[model samples]
Target: MAFLELKNIYKSYFLGKEEFPVLKGINLDFELGDFVSILGESGGGKSTLMNIIGGLDRAFSGEVLLAGQKLNHSKEASLNKYRRETIGYIYQSYNLIPHLNVLDNVALALDMTTLTASERKKRALDLLEQVGLQDHVKKYPKQLSGGQKQRVAIARALASDPQVIIADEPTGALDSQNTEEVLALLNKIAAEGRLVITVTHSQHVADSGTRIVRLADGKIISDQRLKPAYNAKVESKLQSRKLPLVTSMRNAFKHFKYHFKRNLLIIIGTAVGLFSVITFNGLGTGVKGYVNEQINSLVNPKQVLVTPYVKSSNNNQRSSYVNLTAGDKTVNTFSNKDIAALKQVKNVTKVEKIHTLSNVATSFNKKSTNITTVTNWTSVLNASSIKKGRLPKTGEIVIDKKNIAKSLTNNPNSLIGKTITLTYTGLNKSGQKATITIKVKVVGLTESSGSSQINAIGGNTIENALKAANMSTDVAALGVSASSMNTAKKVAKNINKLKVSGKLRFTATAVSSMLDRIETYISLITNVLAGIAGISLLVSALMIIVTMYMSVSDRTKEIGILRALGESKRDIRRLFTSESILLGIFSATFATIIALAVQSLANSALSQIAHYSFIQISLSNIISAFIISIVISLLAAILPARHAASLNPIDALAGE
Candidate 1:
C-alpha cells in the first residue's frame, strides 16, 4: 500500500453558474522517503493538486487514502485532524506572523498540543537550530532576510513533526544561493523517512527531487524517476498533546504588548469613564458625610425630637392663639399616659417632658423686653456648648452671650450670676388663665449663632413658674434620649409608628433621618451624572471594537497561519477576546488608582477649610467598576472576534 494515495481526484471552480475545471481525474501515489516534484507551467493544476493533498482544499471528489485510511472530505474535523497530524505546508510567501518573533512563530504549530510551555519553546528552538537559524530565533519576520524568513517557515512547518511536507513554489522568491540552501534542507527532510512534495514551474527545481511528475492542461503529461529514494537516518515521531488555555492567553498578551502605545490610549479613554463614575460616587459619599457632621454638631444624635401629631381640624391659628392665652385645654397635648408610654420604648435611656413659652415678657432691672421664645433645658445640649457657667439649676437660666450683651447687660459674663425677671400668661393645672412672674438667676452663657437666640431655663424652674401662675403644666411632648445614634434612629422609627387611642398622637424626628434623606438625594443626582458620563464609555467600547477589527485586519495573515497550524475557530475567538479582557482589566485598574489619588488630593485641600476628611471610595465600588468595565469591553469584542475566527485561511494568507 502507498503511504499517500490520491485516487482519481477531480476538482473544479464555478463563477456564478459557469464551471472551470482545474484538475482532471489525476491519480497519484507517494511513499515515505520519496521526494516528488510536481512540475507544471502557469495555468496548469499543479497548485490545485497540492492544495488537495495538503488538506487545504477539500471541495473535491477524491479518495485521499494515507496508509490505507481514506480522507473524509465531508467532515471538517477529520480534515483538520488529518492536516494537523500528517501534513505541513510551505507557502511561497513564507507566511510568518509579523508580530511574533522567529521562535514564537515556530512555536505556533506546537501550541495545538499538550506539551508544557517550556517544552514547546525548547522544541521550537531545536527546530530553528536544525535549520541553522538558532541565533535569529528572537528576531521578527521583517528583521530577517528573505532566505532567513524561508528557513524559519521551514522550521515552523516541521515543529509539529508531520509526516508529509507540501511545498508550493518554495524557492520561487529565492536567489540561486538561497534556493540551493532550501533545496538541500528539503533533501535532508526527505532523507529522514518523510515524504517531500514540491510544486514548481522550474524544471531546474524539479531535477533536485527523486521523481518528477509533469502536468499540462490539468493532466499529467509525463513521469520520470531521477534517483532511488534515500534511506532514513532517523524517523521523527510525534508525542501529540492538547493546547492549554494559558498558551492562547500568552499569545494574546504578546500581541497587546506589541502594540502597547496604541492600546494604552484606548485603555485611557475607557478609564476616563470609569474614573468619572467612581469619583462621582465618592463625591456623593463625601457630601453626605459633611452634611451629617454639621447636623450632628447642631443637634445631639442621641436625642429623638418628638412633636404632637396635630390633625388638620385643630392646626389653625385659632388653636395657637388659644394656647397663648393660657387656658387652652383644647390644644392637643401629651398627658401623663402618653409620657409613660414613651418611657417604655426600646433604647430610651431617659424621657423628659419639655415645656416652652412664646412671646414672653422679661425684665432685667427695668430694661423690659418681650422674648420671642423660651425653652427649658433637655438632654439635647451637651455640657461643652455652654461657654461660661454650668447648666441651669432650679430657678436659674442660661442665655446666649450675645443675647445678654444686646438685651440686658454690656458685659455678658458679669450677668451670669445676676437675676432676671420673666412674665408670661399660662394655664394652671385647673385649665384656667392667669399672669405669671418669676425672678431667675442666670447661671450660664452659651455661644450663640447669628441665626437664632438661645435662652434655656431649668425644667423644674419653668414648671414651677407655670404652676404658680395658674397655668396648666400640661407637657407639650416627650423628649426621648437613646443610648446611641443608631439606637435612637431605630427607636424613633418605632415611636412614630405608635398609635394611642386608635389615633397617631406623636411624630418622631432625628437629625440622622434628615441627613439620610439628604444623602439619598445626593446619591440619586450623582448616579444621574455618572450615567451621563457612562455614555462616553459606549464610545470607548466602540473604539475597542474598531481597534480589534483593525487588529484582525492587520493580522489577517497571522490568523491564517494559526488556522493552518490546526487552531480551531474557538481558539481564534479566544485569542481576540483575551486581548479585550486584558484591556478592560488594565483600564479599570488604572482608573481606580487615579480616582484614589484624586480623592486624596481633594480631601487634603478641602479638609483645611472643613476640618474633616470627607472624600471616601468603598472597596465594593472599586470592584464594581472593574467588573462593569470588563463586561462592557468583552461584549464589544464579540463581533470582531467572531469575524476574525471565521476568516478563510486561504484567502487570509492571500491578503496583505
Candidate 2:
C-alpha cells in the first residue's frame, strides 16, 4: 500500500447560492522515501488540494488513507489526530512565531506530547542543527534572516516525525540561494525513509524531486520520473538530516511571551475598572454599617417609637398638628380622653406621655438661648444616659454638659456639682411672675443626639426652662415602653380614633409611618449611588470592547497563521476568549486588593478622628466587592470576544 494516498478527491466552494467546484476527481499516491512535487498555475486549486490533504480544510468528497488506514469522515477526532501525529506542514511565509526563538519554534509541534521539558529542548535543538539553524536556536524569528526562518519552519515540521511532510511553496519567499538551499533540504528529508510532497509552480523545484506531477485546471496533466541517480542523492541527504524526536514545548512559551505585554496591559486596564467597582461597593457597605451602628446606639433596640399622624384638608399636606380650642377659633391639644383610650390598649407594660415645649429661654448672666425640651417623662425609664449627674427629681434639674460649660465659662467638669440659677418664664398664677428664678444642683451631664457638649447643654437647658413655664404643650406625641410593638401600635391607633371623634388636635406614635419614611430615604440613596456606579460600569464595558477590538485587529495575521497551520476554528476562538478571561481574572484580583487597601486606610483614619468606637467594616463587604468586580469584568469581555471569534480567517489575513 502507498504510505500516503488521496483517492478520487473532489472539492468545491459556494458563493451565496451558487456552487463553485475547485477540484474534480484528483487521485494521488506517495510511497515512503519519495520526493513528489505537484506543480500548478495560480487559482489551479494547488493550495486547496494541499490543505485538504493536510487536514486543515475538510469541505471535500474523498478518502485519504495513510499507511492503509482509511480516514473517517464521521469522526472529527480521527482527523485531528492525523493532523497532530501523522502529517507535518511547511508554508512559504515561514509561519515562524515572531516571539519564539528557533528552538521554541521547532518544539511548538510537540506541545501536547508527554516528553519532559529538557528532553523536548534537546530534541528541538537537534532538529535545528539538522536544518543548519542550531546557532540561531535562542534568537527570535524577527532577528533571523528569511532563510534562517524557513529553516526553523523546516525543523518544526520534521520535529513531529510524521510519515509525510507537506510543503506549500516553502521556498516561494526565499532568495535564489535560500530557495535552492530549502529545496535541497526537502530533497534530503524525503530520502530519509519519509514521504515528502511539495506544492509548487517552479520547474526548478519539480526538477529536484524524484517524481513530478503537473496539474492544469485541477487535473493532473503530466507525470514524470527522474533518473535513479536523482533518487540516490536525495535518499543519502535525508539520512544525514534525520532527527530522533518529533515534538517540543517551546511553542507554548513562545505564545505566552509574544502576547504577554499586550495581555498584561489589558489585565491592568480591567483591574482599574474593577477596582472602582470594588472600592465604591466597599464604601457603600461601610457607610451602611456605620449608619446601622449609629441607629442601634441612638435608639432602644427593644423599644419601638410611635408618632401620630393627622389628615389635613389636602391629602398631600398631612399634618402632625391637632386643634384644641373650639367655638370658631379652635385650639389643639391632647385631651384626657385620648390618653385614657391609649392606656386601654393591650401590652400596656408602662406608658409615658411626653409634652414638648419649644422657644423656652434660659439665662446665665445675660447670655441666654432658646431650647426645646420634653416634659412628663423625666425619670430613669424615660432618659437614656447621664454623663455626670442623675435625672431631675421634684424641683431638681439635670443640665446638659454644654450648657453647664458655657454658663461656667469652662469645661462641664468644673461645674458638675455647682449650683446654677435657672429662670423660668410663663408662670400662670397672679403675683407669681411668668419668670421664676430657681436654684438647682447640677447633677449628671448627658450626651446630646450627636451634638457637641456646648450645643447639647444650651439646647436642653433652654428646653427645661420652657417645660417649667406651664406653657401649653403638644401631648401624646412620644410614647415610651410598649407591652409589645404590636400592642403599642394598637394603642397608637386607638388614640388616633379618639382624637378624630372628639375633633381634638392630638398626635400619637405611628411606628410604621416613621419606619417607612426612614426605609424609603435609605433605599433612595442606595439606589441612586448604585445606579450611578452602574452607569460607570457600562462605560467600562465599552472600554473593554475597544481594547479587545484593537487586540483582534493587531493579531489578525497571527490568528490567520494559526488557522492555516491545522488549528481548527474552535481553537482560534478559544485562544482569544482565554486571553479575555485571563484579563478579567487579573482585573478582579487587582480591584479586590485596591478596595481592601482603601478600606483599611479609611477605616483607620475615621476611627482615629471620630474618637467614637462605633464604625466597623464587615467581611461581607470585601467579598461582595470582589464578586461584583469579577462579574463586571466578565460582562465587559463578552462582546469583544464574540467579535474576535467571528472574524474570517481569509479577510483577517488580508487586513480587511
Candidate 3:
C-alpha cells in the first residue's frame, strides 16, 4: 500500500451566490522514498492540493489515508498531531520571524519537542551546517540575503525530523547556484526513505524529481516517471512531546529582551503608581511615630484623663465640658456621684480633682495679658518642659515661656520671684457677678513642649483665689492614677463604664490609649490616600492592556510561527501572559527601590526640624505593593492574551 493516499478529493470556494471550484475529483498515491513534483500554472489548484496534503486545509471532500489509517480533518487536535509528526512545509516566501535570529528560527520546531535546550541547539546547528549557512546562525532574517533566508526556512522545515517534506516553490526565490543546492538536498531527503513532494509551475524544477504529475483546470493531464522509486533504508517519525512551561517563559523573556526599550517604558509607568502607594503609607507611619513620641514625653503614661461624657452633636468632636460655677445649673457636668464611682475603679491609687478658669487677667509691673488657667497639680506635667525654678507652690504661679518672656519680661528667669496680680469676675456669694484681685509670685516658667493644661497656677493657690472671690471651685475633671501604665489602661476601661442618672456621665482615657486612637486615625487616612493612588494603577493597567494588544498586532506572524511549530492555543496565551508578569515584576522591584530612596531623603530633610526620622517603609507595605502590581498586570493582560491565543494559525501566518 502507498504511504499517503488521497481518493476523489473535491474542494470549492464561494463568492456570494457564485460557486468557484478549485479542485475536483483528484486521486493521487505517494510512496516512501519517492521525489514527486506536482506541476501546474497559476490558479491551477496546485497550491490547494498541497495544502490539503499538509493538513492546513480541512474544508474538502475526500478520504486522506496515511499508513492505512484514515485522516479525519474534522478533529483539529488529530490534524495538528499528524502535521507535527509527519509533514514539513517550506513556503516560497520564506515566512521567517522578523525578530528571531537564524539559529532560533531553525530551532523553532525543536522547541515544541521534549529535547533539552543544548540538544535542540545541536540539532538546529547541524541542519544549518547541512545547508552551508552555519556561519550566519546569529543573524536575523532581515539581515540575510534572499537565498540565505530560504536556506534558514529549509532548515526550520527539517528540524522536527518528519517523514514527509512538502516544498511549495522552494527554489523560486533563490539564485541559480542556491536553487541547485536546495533541489539536491530534497533529492537526498528522498534517498533517505522519506517522501519529498514539490509544487511548482516551472518545468525544469519538476523534471529534477523522480515522478512528475501535470495539472490543468483542476485535473491531472499527464503522469510521467523519470526514475524508479528507491527502497526504504529506515522509517523515521517525530516523537510526541509537550513543550515545557519553563521553556515557554524563557522564550517570552527572549522576546522581552529584544524589545527592552519599549517594555521599560511600561515598567516605569506602572512603578510610578506603586511608588505613590508605598511612599504615602510610609509617610503615615512616620507621622504616627512622631506624634506618639511627643505625646509620651508630655504626659505621664500611668495617668488616665477622666472627663464627663457630655453627649455632643457629632460623635467625632470633643464635648464642651467645663468647670461648674456656684450659680450654674447644667446637668452635663460630672457630678459627685460620677467622681465617687471613678475612685472605686480597681488599680486606682488616687483621684485628683482639676479646676480650669477661662478668661482671666494677669499682670506683672505695668504689663498685663489675658490667660486661660488650669489647676495644674496633675502628673502629666513633665519636669523636662519646665524652663524655670520649680512647680508652682501656694501664693506663686507658673507662666507660659513665650508669654512671660515676651509680654511681661524679656527673660523667663527674670520673671521668677516677681510679684504678679490676678483678677477674676464671676458669680459671687451674693448670687451676682463681682470682681476680685489677688497678688501672686511667678515661681516657674514652662516651655511650649507640654500641653495647654501644663502651663498654669498652683491648684491650691487657684482654690484660695476662688474662695476670696466668693466663687465656686467645683472640679472640672478628675485625674485617675494607677500603679503602672498597663494598669492605667485597664482602670480607664472600667471607669468608662460608670454612669449617673442612667446616662453616660463620664469617659476615661489613658495617654497610651489616646495615642492608639491617633494612630488608628492616621492609618485610616493613609489607606484612603493609598486608595486614591491605586486609581493611577488602574490607568497603568489600562496602559499595559493597550500595549499588549499592540504587541499582539505587531507579532501576529510570530504567533503564527509558534502555532505552526505544534504549540497549543494555551501555549500562545502563556507566552503573552508571561511577558505581562515579567513587566509587573520589573515595575514592582523598581518602585520599591524608588520609594525607599524617597523615604531616606525625606527623613534626612525633616530630621533637622523634627529631631527624629519621619518616613518609614515597612516590609508589609513593600509586599502589598508587589502583589498589587503583579495582580493588576495579570488581569490587564487577560483579554489580549486570549485574543492572541484564539487566532487561527493559517490566518495569522498569512497576515502582513
Measured by lDDT, the strongest candidate is 1
Residue pairs in collision within model 1 = 113-241, 113-242, 114-241, 114-242, 427-471, 427-472, 428-470, 428-471, 428-472
Clashes of each: 9, 28, 0
Task: Please give, for residues 383-442, the per-residue lDDT of candidate 1 as tens digits.
Answer: 555778988978888876765535786677888788999888855667577787878899
What's the CA error at residue 350 for candidate 3, in Å?
A: 6.1
Clashes of 2: 28
Ranking by lDDT: 1, 3, 2
| Weakest lDDT window of 10 consecutive positions for candidate 1 | 316-325
Off by over 4 Å in 1: 233-236, 296-303, 312-331, 344-349, 355-477, 481-503, 510-512
- Give me the overall lDDT of model 2: 0.62
| C-alpha lDDT of residue 619 in model 3 | 99
lDDT by candidate, in order shown: 0.83, 0.62, 0.82
Leading candidate by TM-score: 1
